[model samples]
Target: MGLFEKLFPRRPPDADPRAYFKTLTAYQPVYTTYRGGLYEMALTRAAIAAFARHCSKLHLEIVGDFRPELAPVLGQQPNPWMDASKFIARLATIYQVQNNAFIVPVEDAAGRLVGYYPVLPQQTSIREYGGAPYLQYEFWGGQRAAVELSRAGLLTQHQYEDDFFGADNRPMLPTLQVMRTQDEGIVNGIKNATTIRFLARLAANLKQKDIDAERKRFAKDNLEGNNTGVMMFDSKYADVKQIESTALVVNPKQQELIRESVFEYFGTNEKILTNTYTEDEWNAYYEGSIEPFAIQLSLVLTAMTFTPAEIAQGAGIIATANRLQYASNNTKLNIVTQLFDRGFLTHNMGLEIFNMPPVEDGDKYYIRKEYAEVSKLNTETDPTGTTEPKEGDNGDHTGDP
Candidate 1:
């Protein structure tokens, strides 16, 4: 080797663990997502669950021969214990909640791929062992496991600063704070609405203990048990004034904006969560949210499952969602009526659009043959399959019979 090449030889990617997992100083918080569970917010949690459920409806399939076992395994159940939909939903939820997710393959005793599982580690650290990268998982139950990086598919969003992992939800803290404050204000308002409060002038010579006793006596007599809606005041007070308790009047517009900010962050809205989105809205959501997820997962799983050569040979995985499934009944009817006879879709497929069970012979494709090809309408070429124009007939036949 040349002297320069020998002296400055590049190290492999797994040479150092710190390269991917940055070491934080003592003042900085430890590795955690959303600053240690901001998703506990009801709105955020609901949005994540709804978004995940929507995405998990999509299908994941293996496209090539590199991993034939995955095709069947991904169809309905990825593992013996978990259904495919549940697996995908949990994966999506973890990825959203933590800003990162890891998918590791499960193998049988024979070393054959049996299933796939998404791991949620309370703490994740990268380690280098024998010149290879490994992910160390620390579970909340005090259980731990290690897996080679190559065997796991890592998916992350909002990724920046860190090399492999995604950034935390610190940027979203302000929005969540608004939501949190608004909720608390509403709760406080609801409580204050039903209670009657008053301020009254008391006798000047009354001691603190006497005043406390008087207040307790008033509460017990007027507010504790069921009684007529009336209060009798003694002459000890020079003035008595009832305080009007108004419910928390949060700015409706400000609250809407905050909700919109959260919805935008999570790629969802009230309509999306409630499943009232129109066809166009659903399509937009699918394109903006689900499609990118599908693409990333496809790539991540493809890489995790195949070698470079295998990928080059057209072996890969694909995840897809049927946005049309969310179309309105009228739109679905139109689609079925328009495309069914064109042979672009089969009878069973059209039925699927309506969520109906397939009938006998539904697999058959029926294409209309009543219409003939333009060239085959030629008067000069009856019973001949040739579509070529005649040499003299190339000129426009302007004669009008």
Candidate 2:
């Protein structure tokens, strides 16, 4: 037996590729003090929520003369199970949490591509054999299956030593820890402030049993909100005070600091979370965060879905966000008008920019009559030394005279 076979026993050809022996199973990740698993990390850290929301809202589109039949499947809806937006949202969450997203293509019996199904990063494993990596998928707690990379689609924003997987956001451990601590402190402080405490004083001559009875009576009567007033003898004294908490005041500063850090880590700003960004800031944010992801997703989708010949024939995929989403109506109108007036954009193209159907002769480019070449302008001026009207000016003089 070869070394590859020795390391991983080969499965029977007829056996289901999704089934694997227990011995071949890989180790699962455990929650750590600094970070938890995918779901836990998202739940505990506010940064993940911001990242997911920001990425999910950004639109995704495929741009290219690609397969017409595959458009509905890949562009409009990734699968019958979910629409394109939902699929992208799920993919974005997976990418942010694990830094890698894997999709399995579902094909019909005729071998035509139908839909794509996303697999959780934690539920999948990568194994190397004969110097190449193979993906292993696990489900229902123990069932394992191996899939070839060609059959599976993968998207990764950051590359790592392991070719099969991407680098995770584990480096943010310290920041996450600080944020977690701040959150816990704020929660504890709020709890303390909401709690009620009592101070009681008893007469020195009072018996121990009488003191105990008084304490019990105070607890039974004063603890509940129903007892607003309490009757006490001269020997017994009690006062109820609400715990003064600094959390309401102190936590805001810490919370703001944490929010800034979280937004910075995700390459977004507070305006995005607050929905208060100006037009210019929103454009910059889209360029920095949303555009890159869309481009990467387009490249991966094209490569996985199209053949070399098809790609060579101008067949590819591209993800584009709606311009209206980032820019206001006035901004879009100005841009389109400027480009069109300068002859940089044709009428049809301008119409397309507004998502309107092109009309006849819309492909023609027009320039303003006042914009003439410098040489043409020079020719139009009089070359004579004196600026005097010559004979036949305006063709009113008669040559016969």
Candidate 3:
């Protein structure tokens, strides 16, 4: 061994727990009852659920000549524990909340791909060693595990940023604070409304004992929702007046604005929460929000699951959202008819549009007779536009001359 090597032995890169321990602090407030429970709030819950549902409905396909043999593992069932829909939904929720999702591939005894598992971003941390990233996973039971990025089998889908870790919704903290305050105000208003207050007028010289007796009688007779009459002494001069209760008034526009802020931050819209989006609006939402997610996921899956040689040979995965899901049957028919009439789409392409099998000779393109090219404008005329024929031409061009 060299003198330098003998003096200081080289060690494999190890994850530093302290590096990510601070991020856990940021998550602490999110687990609290008031703030963290925002997910359970109507607006927040609805937005997250809608976004997650949109993502869950996407269809993943292996689009290449040399398709990977792990289609079932990646598409149908990520593992025996969860199907594709459930897995995708969970990942979507994680993505909505944390702005990042991590998929760890499970391997069989022979190191062949078997299943997939999702790791919570809050429980995972990334650290760099020797200029390469390593992952440190802290399990629920306080178990800590480390894996190098090269062998981590982890695929990450996240909003693009320079951090490489991922972007989060921390930017929404101020808006969330306002939402929490509003919720607390509403709850407090409701609670205070239940308590009935009464203003009582008494004689100037009434005795303390008499005043106490009158107050007790008022409480007993004026029980909530009970209007029984109470008799009082004439000398007491007691008069009871019930305090008016006003219903809490929440501004509809302000509430909508707050909800919209939350939805917009998550790349969704208010229509998803209300389930009132038109077909076109739904398509726009998919394109704006879900399509980017699918693309990022496809790229991540290809990078993590396929070998460099396989990718070079055009073997990779693609995640595609079913656009037809948001389109009506009539709309699909109209679109297909228009495309077919314009000769912009082939028969097989039309079939693929509706997800049907292609037929023989379906690849041909056609144009209307009137729209066909006019070579000479008339079959009887030559290129010079002359109808006369030379010496060897008969009347029928049969060489009988």
Candidate 4:
């Protein structure tokens, strides 16, 4: 080993006792929306109930259909052919504003709501296939009209939502018309899309489960649902192409792990750990390690966990560094050196105030530059009026601002 390497050989201290149990085990939040317009949509009453059963076993909250009023709203105007398209557009507007519906709080074994998934109705077709895209009706005029008007109107154009102030934060789904046109015979395309999105969201929420229990539930739920002949398929030139379909969307076990981890991070309350740290420390950690690790680990974990990982990963790092700084044998220089030498610690992991990872030759880690100039704005000395007693001014205080 080189002199610098040997001199700075990393040591394994008791990595905070809290960290041993923080193995990405928390449940993340997820939601699923189903469309029931099609007779053969996979999200049948029985299917949804079965999916809910599996979700319960994995600590995932199940959100059923939100668009139950679709038919009522569309059929309200007494025009199924022309006004139907306009009605679908209005539904899209409502969906864009509210973003989600039917928020289900996923609980841990202790019945604490760690994360939430909100189910919505499949209001738009996400499927783009063949010469005639399934969701094409909303974007352009269907067979009767030459130009595809906005689903609702020009005011609520889908492209308008593609801006910085747009509703991309809101999720979307396929409208019944889009689904019907995409798949002839009104195949359960809406239900399938809703189910797929829900599963994807669920997979992005929790991880780690009681493997045996999860597997058993998976098998049971798969069999419990009727065949129903609801299949996920791709349409090619008006030809039906069946895609592989599974009863369960995500691995129940991985989701359990992520959910467990998030729960631990959130503790019993629904609050994230970001509020637990002092503001300065919070800024330092976020700008340094928290954001980086959260981005990196999201690859292995779910979106639900990504939220907490961004909040909690810094906990262990901060605690470790604090403990080392307190030990007499460990100084700031030594701590920074050991931290850098650790294989898992990335340069951008926020190791500053000591020997930070050298800035790359042509990289822009910071653009505003003012962050570096942030003087320690001591709250103790700010002009909130002296918290400490002033000379002879506090005993007989007269109130005046």
Candidate 5:
């Protein structure tokens, strides 16, 4: 009914899931637990989200003229179902959380690579079939598919021991447990501070029923909204003391340790997660987290999308971003204004630095007229326009030329 719906309609329920993973072998019903379940935690989710958001902003450009037919699909929109932002965001999130993510080619009716998509299955494994390596995917609904391992791209981290997959988050469990303990301590502390308001010693002469009635009466009279901050009590109690309530103060050092654990593991810092990072911190975070991901994604996609011959001909994929996006406005201004006048940046490149679209013939390079080759400068004449006075003439340059 809406314009957006008309443009990007939802997939039909009856459509086959093969739109994602193109299988070359029989499906498997295997169901294995994935270790990425830790992404559901708060800090883990925050780290992944921050990483994915920045990664999604990167531009996936297909370099060279090798795969002209598939360039449009792979560059802006990996698949018809999702745009570049959604596709890259989902891929980055999966790669960061799972430590291993896969991208398989989506073929057309003629078996041509039309688009590529990340297939996130509940279980995935590499199997050998007919002397060839095959990658298998098992979905949560018990659906499964298999593809040639060479045709699929894999991005992995913590991949020291396993030949095909990355290691699990076993070492990080202790740090996570410390975080859990701190949270529980805070919760229990708050319960203690807020639950019991007063401690009273009742007179021993009162009967059990009288004591119960006195307790209820005291609560009804003093705890009700009608009563002011002043808590009033009768002579039924021998002694009474108001409990002091204070906030649960977690140890700053312990909290810092927990934060450092997360930051180190994710290769990020508090400023990056909070979006208050300086230019230096942003560059560090980009190189540590985002640049590596872009590099890996570029290499994997290039290898998966092209043959050895094509790659040898300089046909490949590259993921690049305007690292200046995180720089301060003044820095960006300097980059655009300074670089533009020197012909260091083309018209489109200058516009792109500010995230603007190119105009007609925007690829042309322009430079200021004052800039010229050093060889072209006249060495004989004084550049100041006053001719040097001859030895015989008085030191006035206007006398002779």
Candidate 6:
């Protein structure tokens, strides 16, 4: 055997991660956001790749990470872009944002951040203002600034699915909905008790990182910001489902920076654009480019809440452990991809919404909402109108489209 096979004897020779990941027929797609400058699309791709590298090194497994060997066994992967697009297209058909620009999905490889095809203003008189720049320079600058808001960590990563299964149900098996049998003849009259228990353990093992400590650790190690942090948390009792919390740098100077960033985003005069451009002109120029960037910025802020030191200092952060559980390589890349798909996030206008929970016994408990809001984007508009083309799918578009 060759030296390559000595350490990892079972790894496939043609182990392209993308190919491998394509095998997960039932895998879900999680969306994440990226903004800032003109190269937001490229930056988002790079960040995701970097995250994947980190997870691979640490050996953590994100659901989207490709594994062809596992594909034949798992079934199929879900096409997220198509699903998101269908949703957005429906919304666009139902509701329009008046003059404001909106985006569906655009990939970096295509040289677009969101699928931004600018719509020009409706000009009534052709001769009076024939050559007026429908979108003034300031409008472009504002749109650019909106992308920058993503740098402020104002975007969110949301994981949703259009359907529960793949377009084709292969490897068919009967669906079994099971529950505990009340008053069965025998408590131990099971033929496969051990196997069922093992499966349950495997499920827990896959999602071990969802625990408060593990999620917080992942956030602190990967996310970066001067005064913000994120942590995973649940209430003290069973009544509370798990949620993420954040922290912020509440000092006056930091607050000022945030406000200025907001001003740049909403335009200096508190409108979508400055006075140099007329309403019709501004609307058309930006009708398709601004909304997604806005969405991305809001989500970034949500991720930036976790502190590196706080997460790294926890007991569960084992340096040498399962790569799937660690925040490196595959894990980071998966997060980056999901974040890119989720779209932009809104800035909370500098509200110190929540605080971080106290650490106990060398373990952090929760996330805070200091100077931030973790609300979803306004859904009154077409939620599905904002999707880009499917890059990795084998052409399986389901649902609305």
RMSD of each: 8.1, 9.4, 9.3, 31.2, 8.5, 35.8
Q: After superposition, how far is residue 342 of candidate 3 from its true place, in Å?
A: 8.8
Q: Once superposed on the true structure, which residue ranges of model 6 sit more than 4 Å away at CA? A: 1-13, 17-256, 262-288, 291-401
- Between candidates 4 and 6, the one scoring higher on TM-score is 4
What's model 3's lDDT at 209?
Answer: 97
Rank candidates, lDDT, best first: 5, 1, 3, 2, 4, 6
| Model 6 residue 319 lDDT score | 14
3 against 4, candidate with superior lDDT: 3
Q: lDDT tens digits, residues 1-401, model 4?
A: 53222211331232111121111323211112233342243222222222222122111111123223222322333122224233333332233333222212233346432332222332322222222212111112212111111111111212242221123222223332333343442245445654432121122223357534543454354434537635332221123233455433334574455444433321211112223444354345343433332232222113222234443443111101222222233454565465554443445443433434656542223332222222322222325645444355454445743
The lDDT for every candidate, in the order shown, is 0.76, 0.62, 0.66, 0.29, 0.76, 0.26
Residues 1-401, candidate 1: write the lDDT tens digits.
53222211333344334433334532221245345456788888888988788878879898877878778888788866688898889989888888899887766655566677787777776666666667766667665566677877889998766666777777678887877888898998879875758887885679899999988887787668638888877887777788887887789899789888889888888998888888898888888888888899889888877899999999988888777778889999999898988888998999888888999988988887666667555434435654455556664667835
lDDT for model 2 comes to 0.62
- Least well predicted 10-residue stretch by lDDT in candidate 1: 3-12
Per-model TM-score, in order, reads 0.81, 0.70, 0.73, 0.16, 0.80, 0.13
Give residue 294's lDDT in candidate 2 (0 to 100): 76
Cα lDDT of candidate 4 equals 0.29
Give a tens-digit lDDT track for model 2, residues 298-394: 7777777888888788777777665454567788799888888888889888777677889998888887645655534322335453334434455
CA lDDT, candidate 4, residue 48: 25
| lDDT for position 380 in model 4 | 29
Error of 1 at 257 (Å): 2.2
RMSD to native, candidate 1: 8.1
Candidate 6 residue-wise lDDT at 86: 38
Winning candidate number (TM-score): 1
Once superposed on the true structure, which residue ranges of model 4 sit more than 4 Å away at CA?
1-128, 131-274, 277-333, 339-401
As for lDDT, the candidate ahead, 2 or 6, is 2
